[model samples]
Each structure stands twice: as C-alpha cells, then as structure tokens.
Target: MRSRRAPLLIAAVVAALLTPAAAAAAAPAPAAQAVVASCSAAAWSGSAVYVGGNQVTHGGAAWRAKWWTQGETPGTTGPWGVWERTGTCDGGEPPIDPPGTEDFPVSQAQFNQFFPHRNSFYTYSGLVDALSAYPGFANSGSETIQKREAAAFLANVSHETGGLVHVVEQNTANYPHYCDTSQPYGCPAGHDQYYGKGPIQLSWNYNYKAAGDALGIDLLNNPRLVQTDSAIAWKTGLWYWNTQNGPGTMTAHAAIVNDRGFGETIRSINGSIECNGGNPAQVQSRIDTYLRFTSALGVDPGGNLRC
Candidate 1:
C-alpha cells in the first residue's frame, strides 16, 4: 500500500527539530512595544502616510509609492503587502563590501553537493527568481548576500519540513486544519489544530484570516486553498517574509546573528529542536547545512555573515 504520510518541506524540519531557546532567551529583552517599524514602505517611494499610529515614508525616489504595513501588532497573526510604488527609492544605505571574495568563490556545484535535494522542490531558476525579487533581503549585489540568504533559507527549510518536496506535499494534505484552534487563526477540530500548510507552515485561524484578507482569499473556511494552488503557497511565503512581526522587526538574518551566530539564525526562523524540540544532532545538522550552503555562494565559512 502507498504510504499515507505527507511529504515535508524546508520549514517543517527546521520548525520541528532545531533549537532556538537559548538564542531566544539571550535575545535583548523586547521593549514594551517589541514591534517597531524600521523603514516605512512610504519611505521607499517618497510618498508618506500615517497608518497604525506610525508614519510610513517611502524610500526610493523612483518608487515613491512603495511602503510597508503590518497585518497586526507585534505578537499578532497577519500578512504584509506592498500595495504600490510611485517612484524608486533606495531601500536603505548599501553595506560596505566584505573582504576576500577572491579567495572563497561559490559555485552551483558546491550548492548541489551540500543541498543535493533543493532541486526537488525549488528549481535553480526559481531560486534565482526569488532572490532577484528581493536583492536587499540579505544585502544586494554581493554574491555572498545571495549565498547567505539561500543557505539560511535552505538550512531552515530543511530543518523545518524535513525537505522541500515533503513540505509541499504535507502542506497540501493538511490544508484544512491550518490556523483553526486556540491560536488566533487555528482550527482545533483539525488533525493538528495548528497544522496549517505552505512554505512557512502558516497555522492559526487569525493568520489564515489575515492571509486570506491580504490575498483576497477566504482561507479561514477553505484552508486547503494553499495546497491546491501553488501560487497561493508562494504568496504565503512572500507574505511571511514581508509581514510576520513587521518590516525590519526581527528578520531571519538578524535573529541568526543575535545570540549564537549565523547558524543560530537558521535555527530560529526554522525553529530549533533543542529550543523548540529538544534535539542536539538536529541543531548540528543545521550548522552543517549552513556551512555547505555558504560554500556554494563562494563565501568563506568564518566571515562576519550578518543580515
């Protein structure tokens, strides 16, 4: 008989096995309002607006209409959207280049050697497409930036959902239960109550409601929409990347750099076994994945890889 178990994704393995507790514990105590808007989406486009008790300033002169908004307050579930861009503005000041791009150059082969299975779910072209859209995510222009972001994503995803294909499949299977429970967007009646599907494994009724609202879908009642529709899953990932807490709140990169190191960032966003699940080998595996992924991007292993 065919196996009934659903496949895993990068998010599931990371969420299930990595340890983020120590880093989370050591993180600087959150301010009364732990969620502060860093750069206003308005700042990106030069248009200004006041939303949610904050002044949003667009950054780019050419992309003046661009701005960011939180779906909800800190510790709340919601999705973020980039409504428009009137003109272009530099998102932020560019970072100084790190030393030694010459000594440690990354290659596609290296990436495959480490994450041999990435191609199963995300095509090389697809990964490149994702990266090109958000060059500033890890820092623009630098190959190291791409590598770090890719590595971090891969490591965390592997740890989160077991593997890329698995995540997609499992997400498809458990679509209805996502975000329908004690958690704001959760369904307690479902298989896992919080087994919402997709790249970030979006769970909780509030989260589904917000995602549905942002994407203009009614996910609360039809959680399976994410699985049946690949576009929905991709949109959900982008939403998670942009929204979650808020713009510039606590990025996967920043979280990694805080308590332990870059590796820890992978664990935090991906969720750690030790911290979230209580497993050491899983944590070590995450570290190993990080190292291998970095090598592919041609970055030296010990460089100051920060967000």
Candidate 2:
C-alpha cells in the first residue's frame, strides 16, 4: 500500500502525461526498494504454516516462506497455508473471452498508453502474485480470465484513484469520512469521509471497521496502515471483492459483465444510499468507468446500465 499523499503528487504526473509542458516540468520521485523472496516446498518440513512466522521444516521437505505484510498475525506466515488444500492448479477449462468481446474500442497498446503509470504500482507479475495468493480466484479461469479480470480491476482502480499510484497514496490517508451519520463512531471533523482510499475508495469509518474486521485487522485505529501495507490492503480489497452482501456478492463479476446496475452492488456493500447518493449521474460515471475498461479490453458493455 502506498500513501494518500503520494496520489496528490501523482495527479501532477497524470497531468504531465496529458500535456508536454507538464511532462517536462515533472520530476521523478525516488524509487523505493522492491521486496523479493524465494521459497521451496522442502522448507515447510511437515508442519503447517502458522498465522505468525512459525512453520514446520523436516528432512527433505523444505517449505520456504515469506511474510504477507498486510494480514500479519502473530501466527500467520505465508499466502497459502500449509494446512489448506488449494486443489488443482489447473481447472482444465480453455480460456474464453466474455460475451461482448467486440465492443472494446482500444487495443492493448492503447490501454497501456492510457494508463502508463499503472506499471509503476502493479505489474503483470504483481497481479499474478495476487491471484496466486488468493485461492478463491486461483481457478477463476485460464490466462484470459486472469488477464481480463486483472485489467478490469486495475481499470476500476485507475478510475477511482486516478491510477495505482494514487490508490497507494489514498490508502495511506485512510480515506476518513462518515457515510453513516447516525452512528456515533462517524468520521472525525474535517476529514473527508467520502474521499475514501484504494481502487474501490472504501470510505467511512464503518466501512473501515467492517473491512478490518473481515480481514482481522484493527483498521479503525490505523486506517492509514493500509497504505504502507500491500497484503493488508490487498486482502481487504479481496474481502470486499469476495463478500456477497454488498454491491452484490464478491462473485458478481458476471453481473458487472452483463452491465447490470452495479451502483446497487456498491450500495449493498456500503449499506447506505451514499453508495448511490441518489444521483444517477454519479452512478453512471462509475458504470461508464467499468464499461470503458471492458471496452478497452475488447469486450461488450452488456447493456445492463439501468442505474
């Protein structure tokens, strides 16, 4: 996770891309050290990977492991727990493009051109790592599904935060605000509750609490923590993505594909009208963002725009 202050700076970068003068004026920021690790099955020994940093290592069987920065507990260790079974790596289905493949107006190069900064935050390798860590989406489909879905998620995030850099920054800010005024634990004064953070822009203390609770973190006290912690923010996003109650179930990508009214899905997640704000225009903007991404990917918009 990156800091919200970072996105304020990124806005300038985005502006630079829009104009030659801005680009000329822009100075690159210092790059952070990238984290890397290698692991092997033999490092595991024979014991399960604990939630903290403990693991079993025995003769011949070595399960190498690394820490997931975001969702760290005293006992949790790796992305995939040794006790858990991930079934087959391959589900045997040939990857197929979703129904409206022809509606997309942009080529992959054009998509890259539109969001060149995305490569800075999330590379293809990072997305593959995310998919690998999240077992629920591991068998989602073939490479096509992985690519398209990752692109869609990235597209939505790009629109929400202006780009991955912005997402990282805003997450650092922890998007303070209170969508639910009736609650006593609403956002503090002067904090822009609606600003939210991350690609989904999760706003409001309640949402923070809920997301934290789902991911087993104390986000209410440290909302900004999501910015510096990738695994935490990623897991929080995944929890929201997989949960069914809000904005429909986390599994409702097909509904989104059908172009169904997705503001309702967002509303379901937020449990408030703030998600829709009773404003058709704002809702439509979000819908358009999704459509534009799909269209860029050469997919149909699916006509479910009844927001």
Candidate 3:
C-alpha cells in the first residue's frame, strides 16, 4: 500500500522548496581525493528505512540495528533503542506543501454524514487543514467532476479505513514485509512502522519516503505521524489521490478529471492486488461505496464503475 503525504507546520517549508535545490547542487567540496570518504556501509539517511540486521556507518562508527529503525541517529536513540553499537564502521557515509486553502465541495457536516461512526483520529478539521498540500485536488475540473473526485477519494478512503474507524493496519503479521531492503536507503523506521496508517492507510517504507519528500515531512523516520496527526493523515490520502498512479497507468485524480471514469481510480489504487476478477467482492464493495458517495454529492456515478 502507498500513502504519499500534508500540510502541518510544513506549509512554510513546502512553499520554500517549490523551486530547484540550486544552492545544494552548487556546494563545493575539497579537491577530488581529499573530498572522498569511503565506508563499508551506507551512510545513514534520515529518509531511509532500515530493518533488523542492517548496518550503517555513522559518525566514524559502525552500527547495527537490533530491529527495524529509522531517524534514530546511530549514536542517539539511546543504548536500548533499535540500533546497537557495532564495533566501528569499516566505512560509511552518513548524513542527511501547501498550495492554498480554499472552499472544498464537501462540507464538514456532509463529511460527518459520510462517516458518523468514524474514529476521532480522522478529523474533519484535519482534512480541511490538509487542503494546501494539493489545492487542485477536487478543485481542478467542472463542478460535477470536482464532486465526483471528492466522492471517489472519500469513498476509497472509507472503504480502506472501514468508514475511517481503523487508524492503523489490523494485521500485524504482514508488517515486516513492507520494507524493500534492496532500496539503497532501506527502511530506517522499523519495517513494521510503515504498515497502513491514516485515512489512506499509508503503508510501505518507500511510499512514506516519497510522500514525506513531497510534503517536506520526514515520514520515513516518523511514520506514526500518520496515525497521530490528523492533518498529516489526510495529506497522505490526498497525496495518493492527486499524485500516485499506483498499479494503474494514471493517477486517481487523472481518472476522474480526464473523464476516465471512477473504475480507473480503483485500478490506480489497488487494481493489481484487487481488481480484474482478483476479488470481485472487494471491487463491488468499492463500487458500492463510490455510488453512495456520488449520490450524496449529487453527482452521477458515471460509467466504468468496474476495474
């Protein structure tokens, strides 16, 4: 699963990074060999997710993780933290939103109507607060298209979260596998930390990294922020809706905005895992929610309801 990211204290930082990282790119270094530093393991990155048995070189020392970890500085997370002090690193490198607020089609009252029994963690204010991360979301097309997009997004979220009742993934057994060790950064936060959280149930270390990078949040290290911070949680949902295409060829936003139909949005979210007769019941569940949401928004469900 993927949850991209949000507006929090991030509005200012997100605004600042709207352009290129010119200054960072132009930084000077010592002449060739003098500037080179070699390490046996990769230098720790705050954005990376690391798991048990992974090693990293930091502050001239080598450290091994006792379990999945992230953002825990090699020397910092305390002796009992996930990282264990290994002798010394052979070598390693170490180191290193918001568009605007505007009126949204779905009112707070209506949102409540959508999920009256929803968990308090999924706050209406949080969703409204996260609007700056992707202003175009539910605002890029005609009134009908806008409503459809809103409904589609909320519908999927409702389904994923069981009407927003669950804040994190229920099946803990599958948690450890979300990490992709082959990725250079690995899962810095323990592999289990990335399991589905927030409204979109953001999962996977890479998705946290990508989403955090986009929103200027260090999600890879603080993945729990999704469950604890309502605005961040909503932003992750928007991040997936507006940007990630997932298993489908186009983004869910594109699916609705480009007249591609609601079915394509489903394809983009979990098509490879749940579509095309993969599980007809699940597809129908999503479709049923979509239809209900569209009706609430006073919009046509549109064609192509199946993926």
Candidate 4:
C-alpha cells in the first residue's frame, strides 16, 4: 500500500538534514586559542654553575638563583634547591630600593612576642653581627621587603624550635645519622654533634662545614660554637638563611623579596616532608606562624600561603 514516491521523498529529506552546511550548524564551535607569553631570556642549563644572585630563564620566566647550583632546573628543583622567580622575561625587573638597614626590621618586643620563651642563650641582638657580615641579610631591596623577610625567617624558626624553646634537637636518636661518612671533608666534629642547632637548627656534618666555610669559622671542627657562642650560633642561622638554600629551591630571603610568596619559603625549608605529599598539619603550623608574624608587622601576607 506504500507509494513508490514515499521512499524518494524520505531519502531527499534525510539528504537535506545531513548536508555539509546543516552538519556544520549542528556541531559544537571550536575553543579559543590560548595566549602564550613572549619571553626573550636565554634558557637555563643544568651543567652550568650558578652563584648567588645569578639570573637564568626557564619556561618563559626569568629566575634568580639564591646560592650555588648545578644540574638543577629552575621551577623544578625543590625541597633541596635555590631559584627565585623574578618575572616573565617580557615584564622586566621589579623596582628594587637600594639595599639599606636604616631601620632594623624586627623590634625586640616584636621578636619576643613570637618567641615568648626563646632561649636566653640565643640573644636577638647578637644576630646583628651576622646580618652585618652578610651583604644581603635584611639589607637587600626595600624596607617592606626586609620586614617581610625577617618575619618569614623567624616564623619558620619558631616552628622548628617549638616557639623558640629548644636550641638543639630533643630527639637524640637521630643525631648520629647526620654525619655522612661519604663526605670528603669527613665528620670532623665527631658523629653525633651535628644534630639540629641554632635558630635554623642547622643539621648534618656537611652543613656545618659549608656554613663554617662561608662564615670563616671551623664549625666542622668545633660544632659547639653554635651552642656556646651566641653571635656565632645566630651567624650560622643567618648564614644558612642568606647564603645556603638548605633543602629548598630558593633562599628564605628570595621567597619574600622575589615575590614567590611566603609559602615558597616553607617549601624551600621543609618542602620535601612538609609540602605536597608530606604533612599538611606541619605545613599549616608554619603558615599560621607566618601569618601571625606578617600581621604583626603590618605587611600583607602576600599570595600562595600554602606549599
């Protein structure tokens, strides 16, 4: 009973519905293209050595190294490294005030507020000698930058020392492990004395040797200088801060002034265990202290508060 023309009519309708123009109208539109940042700086090289304050480029962004580095790529090395982001190559350098410490960043009262029970042995003023000796310590960039750096530095120290109560590590079992026999210099100060000490609680035999070498002291031979000589002890901490990257991608100083944010400092200090895969509570403790210190100093906490 079907008409012969019915098949032809149906086929014509189907062909009209699936025509190229019809299909094009029915399909979803293509996504907009992403804008890429234009950068002109030379790329970073792993084989090349970079000293403190050296600049390099990676991933279209310019970065400055905090300390000596080789075989570590910027923006990738972490939890044991040094590199600070300056900006995109096209953005140019940020305005940096001439280095000066006309005003000490932290008042004694402010320092006391954070470290209410700080060890009497660790006098705050003694640190001035260490700071004076280091050209970049609290003296680089603007006054605001210096204050933020001071707050960020002490906040981490506060967490490390339990609000500045413990000068040396409480757990003695780990002391002996800090001496790495493989080091060419050897553990000159004996095996167990290389445990955490000073505000940064500098650990390991190599650290003592390197800090001593940088500061012109024999820390490897006389490790107790960190405990007995207050200025020297503080100097070790500052030396670690201003010069050594420790287990971080950037020096603590760079984390604040370089605009990588305070969180980067935490990553720079303890990111291996405290950041990403490690412990959030521990990381938060450091961040909480940083927020308090920054708040106290009347500076914006800045961005990236978490590791």
Candidates in order, TM-scores: namely: 0.46, 0.44, 0.66, 0.65
The segments of candidate 3 whose C-alpha lies over 4 angstroms from its true place after superposition are 1-102
Question: On a 0 to 100 scale, what is the lDDT of residue 167 in model 4?
Answer: 84
Cα lDDT of model 3 by residue, 13-89, tens digit? 86677566765665676564321122477877655889987877776777777788765566555578776666544
Candidate 4: segments with Cα more than 4 A from true spot: 1-102
Comparing candidate 1 with candidate 3, which one achieves the higher lDDT? Answer: 3
Name the lDDT value of residue 269 in candidate 3. 89
A best-first ranking of the candidates according to their TM-score comes to 3, 4, 1, 2
Better of 1 and 4 by TM-score: 4
lDDT per residue for candidate 1 within 216-266, as digits (tens), equals 778777777765565566566555554453322455644432323454454
Choose the strongest candidate by lDDT.
3
For model 2, residues 158-263, the per-residue Cα lDDT tens digits are: 6556655465443535434345667676654335434565556566677777887876677776776555465565555555555545644434344343334344
Off by over 4 Å in 2: 1-114, 118-127, 132-134, 137-152, 168-195, 216-218, 247-277
* lDDT of candidate 4 over 7-69, digit per residue (tens): 887878887879798888878989865333334546777568889867877756777777998
The lDDT of each candidate is 0.48, 0.47, 0.82, 0.77
**Candidate 4 residue 173 C-alpha distance from true site, Å:** 0.8
